[model samples]
Target: MPSEPAIASAPHLNIVPASVTPLPDAKPRRALKVCLLGYRSAPYGGGQGIYLKYLSKALVEAGHQVDVISGQPYPHLDPRVNLIKMPGMNLFETGLTSIRPHHLTSLTNIYEWMGKLTGAFSEPYCFGRRVLKYLKKHGRHYDIIHDNQCLSYGMLDIQKQGFPLVTTIHHPITSDLKIALSAAKSWTERLLIRRWHSFLIMQRKVARELHHVVTVSERSRMDIADAFDIQPAGISVVLNGIDTYEFRPLPNVIKNPNRVMAAVSSDQPLKGMRYLLEAVAAVVPKYPDLELLLVGTPKEDGESGKLIRELGLAKHIRAVSGISTEDLVRYYNEASVVVVPSIYEGFGLPAGEAMACGTALISTDGGALPEVVGDAAIQVPIRNSKAIAEVLETLLASPAWRDELAAAGRKRIEELFCWTRAAQQMTDYYWQVIQRENG
Candidate 1:
């Protein structure tokens, strides 16, 4: 890497502000060396993995040599793109009691083990230490490192070492912490929730220190600014793109009249699955055959399970996990409507996916859903089961309205959410960062 520009006053502290100075023009893109970094990017994992998979593929398609450096549950990348594995304790898989003496021999491992034992989710921090080690040895390998929300202490060191770094803060983890705390039933549960998200402290500090931050939605950028105490001006909002080709409608598939699909991860309270279930229960009396197909697992002993039984919706609602990508698309195509009842989303992938599949969508006016869907889908208020029930009933009765929403949703996705377009925009952002830093 070229020698960093000289610093005058407080030189050691490099604080890059979010600026929106437009780049000069569309110059021919230099075939840049790029590294997409993630702490834990599991393929079957929710939106983060999907973002990595498609974004890297699109960047590779645009002729950039993209390398994904990830910790445990590595990302599934295109054959053309490189995967550099950075291993961690993956303590989520290993129980805390199973820690052996040999594991604690390494100081980093010891720190990670202890953090997990104390209920502090330390993967991001531990992974950052590993990333810093890797980059120190191979600093010349990549022109730029684009991080996927692993804002840890090591990331700050890497930036200080003069590597051009850009981090995408999907949304501030503070929002998650706030929502979780609010949902906790007991004092012990709230304490545990706080401990599990302790890494947000590190992330908050790192986010403010770093330069060239990218976010998936304008709403996320704004929310991240408030949550992390970073300037919104310093953060760039790059809307997440949909894989139009892979997620397109299956014309041969017949839509189910009484079925509604929701693609979510764990039955997290933030997902607002409880509201959807209540809505489903309310609808079942009118449309006796009404069924809710959830494409994610509920914690068998968690609130979701208890609620399902309470609502007597065990038979009416089916929760399935580990479906293949093909099956996901097929479900999207066949469902009467896809509902994303998230209380908030940094970027609503479910809405975009359903739109790409030409499925009519009913989503809450959660963070970024309206921005992503853009009047293409029906919008309901947050945490309103009655509103959900009414809109759903209306959509079920009006096939013509559903058809209008489906067509509009598909067209909206096509125009605004193409992977190629996102890559091009990101590619331009990369050049701007490099050129800005060089000068």
Candidate 2:
């Protein structure tokens, strides 16, 4: 016979409204789970890869969990962020013009093999299938997915799965195709270039359909809108940021007497390395000791290499690849000036990085180089070798102008291109999308 304890009466609570006021120092909330997607993200050289790495690092630093889902040439991300590797056939690895039977395993792989065999690049579409498969299994883990310019059909499936999707198109690939086609010597070469860039059709479609779109620059936003036939209102411009800590001038390094530095990747025609080489040739007679230091590997047996040999610049031009960021920054510090001979750029990260390191900049008026460099850099016309030569010679001859531009470049970067500012702007944009979706 256990004695029952007397039951206490339940307490009643009343809800009341309080005066609503914004807290002056309250921190903004960020996404708890974020996924960034890319087709190819190699941090060693490519801009997209570098974007994925820094953006993920910045997001993670801002108290958000970020994951990068990428294809071949996997991203180099901060250890805090998870990496989801979605590998493709990577036909570029084959090193041969023809695809062998071993390359065809999955249906997607088969399609890619056939496509490449016929001169049509299928990396985007095949990568889409792989991404779709990955997201089907892992999409539930993310609060939002941010695509890094890999606009593909697979994204549609992820969007349909009730997840918020945002895309960052650094620039349009159509620009690359147009530039390459314009440089093609024969109709067959032009046809091949067009076929290879056929993936633009899919990209255009995906970009138009996606609700939240981010691009690196205002110029890029307009170009993408025009290229993809999308409304400018649907796109948001978030300028890219440079890491000043990694890109700062090295005090111990002495500038090279005749060394001029330029950074570029292998695939893009808009980089304008060819024009830079021609400019180097033009200046070699006046400055016998002059040399060009390219911060990228030359494509093997490619047109670029042939041009370099044809111009007899093998001794004067040095192309180094696969170096650490610290070492690359050292090159920037040791150079007389950093040149950006791009026909077009979405945001011109190289220009920003060079300027960040307190290097004198000489850039062509490519897509957004002028916008990035402002009056801090000497601007030249795109694809004009003579202009590049004249600018280089002028800068080399005038120590006063070089020093002034160098100081201005660094100041501009400090004011406009710091990573902290970029991260804050991106965080705000992320919240805006989330609030709009919830509303």
Candidate 3:
């Protein structure tokens, strides 16, 4: 095999000029019938769900008829976009005992149930099988099929069947697997982590076989190409967008001087929550009244929970889950600084969202974070508790500096990251795929 290409440096997108025209084309833009597929798309499920939710909403607002075909814990979408429910056992929520006599008859259900019963994640693969079957019968209804990173063997089959297909890989799962392995406490734990990520075998194979693949960041494009052994030239980059209107700052909300906020979806090693906890603990001795607000809940027996207890942060850390965008924005508004301590991120939506809320920001220079934050927020190296703690202390001590960062961060988001702009660019790409397939 040939060697992988060198990862390109992130482009400096300081601000987008307001007067710039749309994509250069002689033809007028056409409204398309778009189908977005997601194995699972609960906004709280992860970034994939958030991607589906916002993208579909933006597409509909852009005058396209969009249909989201999704699995359990479906996305909350604009009323204009139709949602097609694809039901599986949803074993994670429904549990193993929910299985019935008839469920055993289907191979897909059996695979899903069996996989979860062991330690494997089989949702993407099972969803692909169901999607291929659904599209085989109703495939002609939509002009194009775009999958949200559900890279499975069935996707290759769908492409072979002559459907105009495009898949968006948010980031490579190989990164998650590597991080999980390193954080494992025992050989057995490492094996289980590997088992849980076994779907990457299918993903790697399917990614290379797909015709048109897109990623959320330049960093992801490079990592996906390297991880899946595809040519870097084959993958395209479309940065994820923030819903500025929803995440925008509330000037009336009172700010909390000593509150530091973070949004952590899970207690995963990649999230670097442990480091954030340590940072909070380190600074609390000097600032006894400092508060750490977590936007997501942690498993009580999980690493984060254990650390919170060990560090005596039980009173200082307040975690909330399943919050509406309004509540999230309120939290952001109240915070003195929002920190994203992830060891890696594809596009760093939390950083972008916090910035959009006009909260002063401190983010680790994980994958694509610098690309997102630019010069608007202070950035530190990933997994550095001391660095995060030091920055937190400085930001807290000087309200003027925080205000400056808050203004800069919000301006950066307003000018550079908008869902409407992302939708337009994505629409152009869709037409390109359709045109290529036609010829």
Candidate lDDT (C-alpha), each: 0.84, 0.80, 0.87
List the candidates' TM-scores in order.
Answer: 0.93, 0.90, 0.95
Question: What digit string (tens of lDDT, one per residue) describes model 1 on residues 76-106?
Answer: 7889989999988988986777787888888
Question: What's the candidate order when arranged by decreasing TM-score?
Answer: 3, 1, 2
The digit string of per-residue lDDT tens for model 3 on 18-38 reads: 234544541226789999999
Worst 10 residues of 3 by lDDT: 1-10
lDDT winner: 3
Worst 10 residues of 2 by lDDT: 8-17
Residue 101, candidate 3: Cα error in Å is 1.3
Superpose all Cα atoms of candidate 1 onto the true structure and report the RMSD in Å to 1 decimal. Answer: 7.0
> Alpha-carbon error at 149 in model 2, in Å?
0.6
Candidate 2 lDDT over residue span 1-439, tens digit each = 1111111111221101012222322225545688888888887757888898888888888788888888888877789999888877777875446556776657998887778678887887888788778777868777778988878887877677767788889999999988999888899888888888888888888888888898877778779889999887678766688888888878888888699999986445778988888998999989989888988878768777888889988898788898877788999988998999999999898899998888899999999777788888989999899999999998998888888888888888876766766666676666666666767
| Overall local distance difference test of candidate 1 | 0.84
